[model samples]
Target chain A: MDQTSSSFVGFAGLASKNKEATKMKAKRRKKISGADLAFRICNGIFMVLFVIITLYPVLNTLAVSLNDGTDALRGGIYLFPRVFTWKNYETVLSKDNLITGAFITVARTVIGTLLALVMNAILAFIVSRKNFIFAKPVSLFWVITMYVNGGLIPTFLLFKSLGLTNSFAVYVIPGMVSAFNMLVIRTYMRGIPDSLEESAQLDGAGYTTIFLKIISPLCKPVYATVALFVAVGQWNSWFDAMLYNRMASQYTTLQYELMKLLSSVSNQSSSAEAMKNAGEGSVTPTSVRAAATIITMLPIICIYPFLQRYFVTGLTLGGVKE
Target chain B: MKTKAINMVDLKRQKVLIFWAAAITIYGIIFNYLPLAGWLMAFQNYKPVTGLLHSQFVGLAKFKLLFSDVSFLRVIRNTLAMGVINLAVTFFMAILFAILLNEMASKGGKKVVQTISYLPHFLSWIIVTGILHDALSGTGIINTLLLHFGAVTQPINFFAHEKYFWPIVAFANVWKETGWNAIIYLAAITSIDPSLYEAAAIDGAGRWAKIKHVTLPGIKPTIMILLLMNVGNVLNAGFEIQYLLGNGLVQNVSQTIDIYVLKWGISQGDYSIGTAAGIFKSVVAIVLIVICNHLAKKHGEERLF
Candidate 1:
């Protein structure tokens, strides 16, 4: 079975240089024929339509999130808000649960990404080391995890036995050493010039020093790529939160909170009434839910442009190298 | 004697590396390997109080119950139905999107569209489902547009019906994943020799002709390989979307094996039966993967080991 889809991209660039060359060769400019011109015009229009179809939901959600809750229910909210208001956002943020959930989510993303990167990088380096005595066995041990597992129940039971279930540690521990990530990091590390490390070794540098100073710096692109993948994954993930910390509301992540909020949308009116009574603002559950959805996605959307280059490079490498 | 002394120094140097390796190895064993032993619970009437050891041995009873249970059978059907729908829709949409995106004359258009498209893939399913709920609601844009255009006199309560569940799920999946999935195919297309197009152009082949002849053929291997690999995932009908979107009205159609496992194993405390369902899913998945891998190798296509 596949590991997390994002992690696959991290280590997928081992042989991308050859593929990259092919792509370069394919980039020669050419002229278009009349028929080709006609086809492209139609195709371009079709693609624009496709883009609108794809983007409309997000835009509509934004519209709904911005619209006054009562006005939103009257219908005809399209690209823009009918009765614009920030009350939806105010209601969503004003909820105490959102704050705690956001804290858990932020904490997990930072700590989980750091732990996974550092530990997986170390393991990848160790296994990629040609002269390491345990390299083959260690690689095999991790590789097997990519293909098989003992299923969810046993894994849950294992965590339960270890007293990890419902604890903050459960979020951080199981994800600490991803086999797929290790492979990706190892592949990138393998591409670095061994001479860089060998010369350092001869200069009386230890393995730790060589890894930290030489290989890690050279593999920054892959590291950044993998780090983004891990961070996005950690932020988007709710299953582990639901599974491990189901009993504890304080430990639930924001995604899980949003999931609960969305699920309970069936009883929106009652919740809306409760919120109306609890606060001065009059916000409908539907608008508040949309606001919560926007809040949940805002972090990724904000960082996406800055990190977009990494995603493109990472995905291209993942696709071509595979 | 000097070589022996050098070997000892090398061994000392590797002690730290070995120590780190040991630490990760221990983690792997506990997290991954230890679960294999828990499969024994499937063969026993496992009570959490008694645990695996003191539980009564009941060979194949849970499996028997699973086979006999009508609900489990329905869950299997729902799983297969949704899985096939997901695979078929997502597979085609991704390929078609990639092909069309590749055909665009403007590189900027392609890049911008691709960027905007895969952004949804990054959003958690929670948010996606929330958006879906709003969009598919009676007063939402979809129904509102339909009514405005006189397509229908009344709004279609989409979620209130069970028949729309699989298709809605599949559409949501395609919407979220098409761009991300297309990236692989686009990469394959990029790596296709441009000279093929140059040759076709010299032969008076049109853009469509070039696409049919050169581009499609170029990515055929990728399509075949990915399709074959996805055969193993027939059981993963997706838990999050189904669980979140599904309600009491749609329970019969929405319950997949994972949901079944959660319902029985954790929620209701029928651990043995849940474990049995889990074990069953694993065995079937392993078999499907091996068979698919073997078939890919037999056909001389790219095979994932």
Candidate 2:
């Protein structure tokens, strides 16, 4: 658990050490040998190529989405739009299902992330208490849920029986308390000093007061990390939308709509029908699909910078179990 | 008297904790443990009309049916093949990418590259698959590049071919997850004592030598733990990607156990067989995880439990 502190120091120290190493090796540059230089050059080139390969498809999709739908089918559109127009976007945005889907996606992301954060944090706080009698059993109870569970059919049947199907609750309730998330938050909470809680308790503060006042504030970083995880998961999740709410168009999600659009474009006959249904002969399935794809991914891409900042901490905290 | 007083105070303090625990415990049983009761459906000829209690008992029949079915067997094969391939390739590439990124001289350049690389990861599978379809389509960049490079006489329909399906899925996974997966390994690498690298450098070890001796061994524990964790998930080859990308042409290779369960359980309405398949998968997952944990313990490495 303390590896995080040492790792940060290591990273900070390495950057300066690298500068010193380069300076010390400057005179030995001639003796460095062509092999090492070649490796460095190749590695640099490889990183560049890797970045390009990673970004090309995304940028290409953007180009296709922006290009005239009919012109995009001509097919050499790579980096930039050939015949630029927002018609494809307009068409995708204009779809009634997509609009409703976007609303559902946003609502679920907001409500689910907030609820899961509070619930998981509360559980983490309880288990994190040093003197709590039920802490061990409670932790074990949730931890066991991580390893074994009912499979999809059983889970689906359970949800169906509970009348969660075709409802918005299906999106948030079943996933309310992720065992992995609880573990991550618990791990972070355990790192907090016990004296803080002890001092708070001596001040006549109750467990809930200490948790809400002292523990929660100190745990902001972990909360941010877990919030990003839950938000991204909620936004990106389509399987639930497809599984439980497929017949309920009112509860459709953005990802599900994109999935539908994707499948329509993938299948030949439906793609032709989709092409005609666009009502404008200029808008093809390819462009519409690309536009919808871009739209679906827009929120994630927008928040990715923020996600990147917290994810490493979250991942490492969850990853290294002792 | 003092001990009893302390016990009473402890019990009083436990009141709030007990309420919280009770709430979560109830939610846990309902959501996590309760669904497991539905496993009984696997042993019966389940019918929606009659329900689980009244359904006729049929012992081991659905499991037998699954084993005897060729498609079920093929689905298992596909699931294992894709899962193993994805696991191997993504694991190797993440390690390799972390090492490569570590070797870069420019810190800013490394950060930029890493950021761009993982951009695909946050996108939903639907979007990733959509990008895959667009990129691998006949008129797409892959075929265009192949045509331009004289690799093929004409454009190739990548999705329609069976031989290409597994590789395509593997590649998509690698592209989507390599950077994200590397984050853990990168953290591991960062934690490697700087003294080790200094010692290696003093020994006149080259870049490759340092990577081999210091970096690889430094991250060995992390790698082992992650590998063990993934072993339990080998059956989760993935449902969304396979289901989304699969078509009539490539259905045989593309269908995993999940899709098989979905087809049988939901679409086809064979609840008994679907439950049987689900049970088999869950059993295998738990068994694999327990075995891996045991092996890790014996080997004196990190055990997941």
Indicate the worst ten consecutive residues by lDDT in candidate 2 chain A.
A1-10
Scored by TM-score, the top model is 2
lDDT values, one for every candidate: 0.82, 0.88
lDDT for each residue of candidate 2 in A1-322, tens digit (9 for 90 to 100): 2233333346557657777776687767647578978998899899988988899999999999999987776778999999999999999888899999999999999999999999999999888877777888999989888877888888998899899999999999889998899989999998988889888888999998998899999889899999999999999999999999999999999999888888777775544565576668789878888988888788788767645658888998998554
**Model 1 over residues A125-169: C-alpha lDDT tens digits?**
999887788888998888788667877788888898899988999
Task: Tell me the tens digit of each residue's lDDT in model 2 across B1-305.
Answer: 22423376887987998899899999999999998888999999999899988999999888999999999999989998999999999999999999999888866567667777778889889899999988898788899989999999988888888999999999999999999999999999999999999999999998889999999999999999999999999996678789988999999999999999999999998888998998888888889999999999999998887
Question: What is model 2's interface RMSD?
Answer: 4.1
Model 1 chain A TM-score equals 0.84
TM-score of 2: 0.94
Tens-digit lDDT track of model 1 for B1-305: 22423376777999889999999899899888989888999999898899988999999999999999999999988988899889999999999999999886544455567777778888998888888888888778889889989999989978878998998999999989998889888888988999999999899888788989999999999898788767788886568889888888889998899999999988898888998998888788879888988888898988776
Off by over 4 Å in 2: A1-31, A269-277, B1-6
